[model samples]
Target: MGHLFSKRKSRVTEHDKALLQLKTTRDKIHQYQKRSEATVEKDRQLAKKLIRDGKKERALLLLRKKKFIEEQLKKTDGTLDNIEKMIQDIEFSQIEMQVVDSLKIGNESLKQINAMLSIEDVEHILDETQEAVEKQREIDALLSGGLLTEEDETAAEEELDAIIADAIQKRLPEAPTDVENPEVVLPDVPETLPEAEKKAQKEKVAMAAS
Candidate 1:
């Protein structure tokens, strides 16, 4: 029975048949529109010939026929547009169905995940881990005899300070009191330059002047 049901589900249904019918109708509409366009052109040429032959009334009648065919062409085009859009909308709706099903599955998975994990549960685990770490540290300190005495720590800090001061004093250079401050002179504003530098300076001044 299940196999038979699966077979029936695989078979083409009313919707598939309807879509095929719509496609056939759309093709027929296209053929009719093309024929009508040709008829409009033919009537236009006939009207032009009639006008040339001085039969203005006949020419106007032929033009009227052409206009009627043009109207039919417009109707056929509108019908074709509607049918094509309907087919496209139907096809897109199938995709939307699949997307909805997929979203349902994703939401179910998230629900399952949420069922397994809660905020309070996570916080409890984190608190336990923190307590475990602090306890481990306390145990280690107990085994290793804990920290230095206050007097021993003070003496160690003083020794470190002395070592850093001695290092700084050895690395420092003597102050030079005779060093002059450099003058801020523009390249082109130098009154005189050395012989080799003068040529380059003069060229810079010339370029600046230009």
Candidate 2:
């Protein structure tokens, strides 16, 4: 009777152990599934961000290329005008020497104007390209969680406003009232550094001066 009781007890203990093992295995499988789902969601978000970034980059490149082509076309048109003028001058039989000289001066002036225009166009293109790059960086930082701060968002908004203001100023003439009351305000400059840093910087400056 005692043996029978011991055998029964051992059987129950074995069953409980099996049940616990099974539960642990099930729990592990569930945890694995949850982790996988989270990973997949993260990857999806990253992929979406990458697609957006790529589109922005492509758009900026296209804009820059278009602007460059337009500038080239303008320069080519100016060159064509000069060429036609030269051809006309060659065909003229009663062209006075003074008229020929004047045409030469006009051609020179046109060349200078074209050069200045080209420089201005190139500078404008550079500025726009830099702005596009900066915007992309900002977007990248935001998507990557690097700039997940209210201050960052506020700064981005200010920068965007400044960019819009600049564009508006370029496209429209300033009103007299606008000139009198500037919409943009300059940021305050720091007048002094931290005490320790200031002392260190002053020492460095003294050393450099010496």
Candidate 3:
């Protein structure tokens, strides 16, 4: 939340100030150039008028002054170009500074993370976790009558098999435990049945076959 509300610090530096000053100089030069151009044109027109009025020396002097002002204006144009190049260099330098600052921040963040989770620290945490899991398993074994143990995997397996067998036995029908002996009276056995019974038996056999 603090980060969300915080304002970023200004990145402006000496280079920016220098650039502003240079631009100011360039603008002043531009104004001077305009004034110089106006002066040159005025001189040129005055010189022509002087020549028509037969003041040849004065017209020549005015022409000389006009040439000097044009030279100065040209020099100012070169200066303006240099200033523009300087401004571009300063701006590019600012971008470079930003890149460097970003790299520094990334490096610092990595350092902090490494410090927090060093190799030794991570190894220690893993060992503690393994020990805790082993202790929990022991506790569970004690609670379950020590039937489960890491060192005795066969015992745990045998216990599971026994439990399954018990479940199966419970699901099966119980066998009769009480036996009653009954006497049977002997009856006469005839070698043949009556005609109707014999015929009915034959029809039942035929139906089953079909």
TM-scores, all models, native as reference = 0.45, 0.21, 0.49
What stretches of model 1 exceed 4 Å from their correct place? 1-24, 50-64, 88-92, 114-152, 155-210
Clashing pairs in 3: none
The TM-score leader among the candidates is 3
- Candidate 1: worst-modelled 10 consecutive residues by lDDT: 1-10
User: Local distance difference test, per candidate?
Assistant: 0.74, 0.59, 0.78
TM-score of 2: 0.21
Per-residue accuracy of model 3 over 100-189 as CA lDDT, tens digit each: 877977777777778878898999999999999999998997888676456586775555445544544565565433345334434434
For model 1 the local lDDT of residue 146 reads 74
Give the per-residue lDDT digits (tens) of candidate 1, residues 29-122. 8888888888888888999999999999999999988888888888888898899998888777778876986696667777777999999999
lDDT digits (tens) for residues 1-210 of candidate 2: 123224322244443455455556555555655665565555556555656788666555555555555555556556556555544554453256447756866677777668767777889999999999999999998789786688977886566545544543465543343466597655543444466755565455457658
What lDDT score is found at residue 128 in candidate 1? 100
Report the Cα lDDT for residue 44, model 3: 98
Best-to-worst order by TM-score is 3, 1, 2
**Clashes per candidate (backbone, < 3 Å):** 0, 0, 0
What is the clash count of model 3? 0
Name the runs in model 3 displaced over 4 angstroms: 1-7, 113-210
